[model samples]
Target: MINSVLMLLIASALSSSALAKSCPEVLDSTQRKLNAVEQVNLCDEFQGKVLLVVNTASQCGFTGQFEQLEQLHKKYQDQGFAVVGFPSNDFNQDRGSEEKTAKVCYLDFGVTFPMMARSSIKGAKANPVFTEIARQSGVVPRWNFYKYVIDREGNVVGTFASSTSPVSQDITSVIENNL
Candidate 1:
């Protein structure tokens, strides 16, 4: 009877371990920050927070959106929301070097939110986080500044095109509703 009880306890412990390791597919990968050696795992860092994941290019016409994105990030961050930017050269507009990209994001825009290293955000070579996002949302970024809103549960709840303002009522409503 003691042996049976011991085996049951071990099984329960293993089950809990498995469950703990089950991060959502969309947030399971680690990404290096732009111009930094530090990396972060999306699931570990931003799980249970509403996220605005954007593909950015420093030279795009929509580059000015960084200010608005920063606004949204600041306003809602205390409410468990964050704007995560991924610098992508998929559309041929990103500043070529990481130093230039970092300057655009950090110096020019005063962006405080996480800005990931430059990576492909569309097509076959898209990063794992973006690939999973596209898979779940049924939308792929056609241009720089495309936005994906993910709920605290790590589900893609909304996809906004490049023309959509980060602080528009459409995006804000979803964020407010989720929070």
Candidate 2:
């Protein structure tokens, strides 16, 4: 009986170690949904999916990209792809409050993809997800709507400027190739 118990413990430790190694550091974060109490762990929610991560602002010129982003998300979601938005006021363009931000994203733009609560996207205070993304991609958000495309394994495969359209060939190509 003692030998059997020891073997069970060894198997459990090995399983946990394998799980920890498979989850990328970039996805090792839990974030609240915009204006919602529920939180999602990135690894648990998005592991093995191709992800388009964008830092967004409600009042920015690129806010309209939310529409195309939603389209992208819908088009590829069944194929293990997703578009995740992080609303930010770091550039002073986001709505004044989370309520307003949620309105703009859900009511105005009809954003169906996951949108995280407002957070810092640049400098020292950037959230853990973005900080790790920037570290892995060697790029940072210069303005609202900057995007990073991550592969299923959580490696940043592409970095896009705020000017790039969500449906642009450049962005779509990377997503398609990775997916």
Winning candidate number (TM-score): 1
**Could you tell me every candidate's TM-score relative to the true structure?**
0.91, 0.90
Off by over 4 Å in 2: 1-21
lDDT of 2 by residue, 1-179 (tens): 99999999999999998986688888999999999999999889999999999999999999999999999999999999999999999999995889999999999999999999999998999999899999998899999999999999999999999999999999999999999
Clashing pairs in 1: none
Candidate with maximal lDDT: 2
- RMSD of candidates 1 onward, in order: 2.0, 3.1
Please give the range of 10 consecutive residues that has the lowest summed lDDT in model 2: 19-28
The list of candidate 1 runs beyond 4 A from truth reads 1-21
- State in Å the error of residue 49, model 1: 0.8
Residue 175 of model 1 has an lDDT of 93
